[model samples]
Target chain A: MKTFLFILAGIISGILGGMGMGGGTLLIPMLTIFFTVPQNIAQSINLVAFIPMSIVVTIINIKGKMIEKKGLLKMIIPAIFTAVLASLAVGRTKNAVLQKSYGVFLIVTGVFFIALTTIKLVKKRKAEKENEK
Target chain B: MSKKKETILYIIIGLVAGFVNGIWGGGGGIFVVPLLVYLMKYEERKAHATAIVIILPLCIVSAITYILQGIYNFPLTIKVGLGVVGGGIVGAFLLKKLSNTVLSYIFYTVMVAAGLRILLM
Candidate 1:
């Protein structure tokens, strides 16, 4: 039963991720909250699980010429540096602190998305009004 | 944006996204997508695709770190990973057929609720 739940959680998160939504955000919360998995372990699971899933997508995207290569290295180099440092820091941090921080991150992400959606809607409405004038 | 300024901005985006993703184990793509779209003038679809390119390496690094730290559950990861791979294929198919506006709204609402729940847990 527990294993089933884990797979279900993975599938749901994966589906969202494959659709271009951030799956790890939801996956971590689901595992920690429902399954009582430790925060760190759940996070590790997300990182690992993302590997195979992303490889497949990245290959398809590359083949379709969907990826923008220009300026990519500039972003990737700095990101890789910081990511390494941060992952090391995770080992020394307390689980509770990480959990709380993640909670805050999720709220901020949610609000940000909602705001973006609202802005798009308002712009569309204004454009329609102008068109009808 | 001038070439130098644009380059600096890209580095900043990378720094922040990497930090967030590494600390949290994922979510760098969220930051990358928007920054690429609104700031760097990338089209939405291209930004999404490019984000995967950026995040793939980050996840690889972070996952390796976690494994080295002995924080991984191998069996659990494998089981969940299989599901994720299968679901990813389905999701890719769905992306072609479905409009994301409604889905986005629902997803955002759930994220907020889940965030609150996790905070109070």
Candidate 2:
């Protein structure tokens, strides 16, 4: 049962991650809530899982010619450095604090996603209207 | 934009996005895609693709830290990774056939639901 859940989580997160929408948001909650995994470990699992998933998806995207080299080159170094630093900091935070922080992160990002979608919808509607006129 | 200006902007985006990713293990692309589109003037598709490549390094770095901290679960990671690999292949191919806008709507709904659940927990 546990193994089944893990595989299910992986498949779902992978599909979302493959879409470049970041599957951790879903995976983290799923593991913590359903599997009784601790928040920190769940997060770590999510990160580790991403390594293989990202590699596979990235290869496909690259073959599809979707990747822009310039954008990639510009972001890789600084991103990696900061990512390492933040991860180290996460290691030091207590579980309760980390969980709360993650909660806040989710809420804020959730609202942001809704807002972005709304804006896109409005713009799309306007574009259609202009096209009709 | 000038080459130097564009380079600086991209680096800044990387810093912010990478930090979030490192802490949470995902969602960095949220920051990367928008910044690439608005600041770097990349097409949306190009931004998403470029963000994926950039994220590989960030996830690796962060994952290494988690491993060193001894918080990472190797057996589980491997198991989940296997499933993810299969799903990723399917999703990637589906990208060509699926409407991204529809996919994004689904994504947003999930994000909001997950966020509310976490916050309440």
Q: Which candidate is the best by DockQ?
A: 1
Q: Residues B41-110, candidate 1, lDDT per residue (tens digit)?
A: 9988889989989999999998999889988988988888988998888887788899888899899888
Model 2: per-residue lDDT, tens digit, B11-52? Answer: 899899889998877778777888888787788888888887
lDDT for residue B117 in candidate 1, whole number 0-100: 94
Sequence-dependent TM-score of model 2: 0.93
Name the DockQ score for candidate 1.
0.86
Which sections of candidate 1 miss by over 4 Å? A128-133
lDDT of 2 at A29: 82
- In model 1, residue pairs whose N, Cα or C atoms come closer than 3 Å (at least 3 residues apart or on different chains), thus clashing, are none
Q: Which predicted model would earn the best TM-score?
A: 1
Candidate 1: fraction of native contacts reproduced: 0.80
Give the least accurate 10-residue stretch of model 1 chain A, judged by summed lDDT.
A19-28
lDDT of each residue in A11-97, candidate 1, tens digit only: 999999998988778999998999888999999999999989999998988998999998899999999999999999999999999
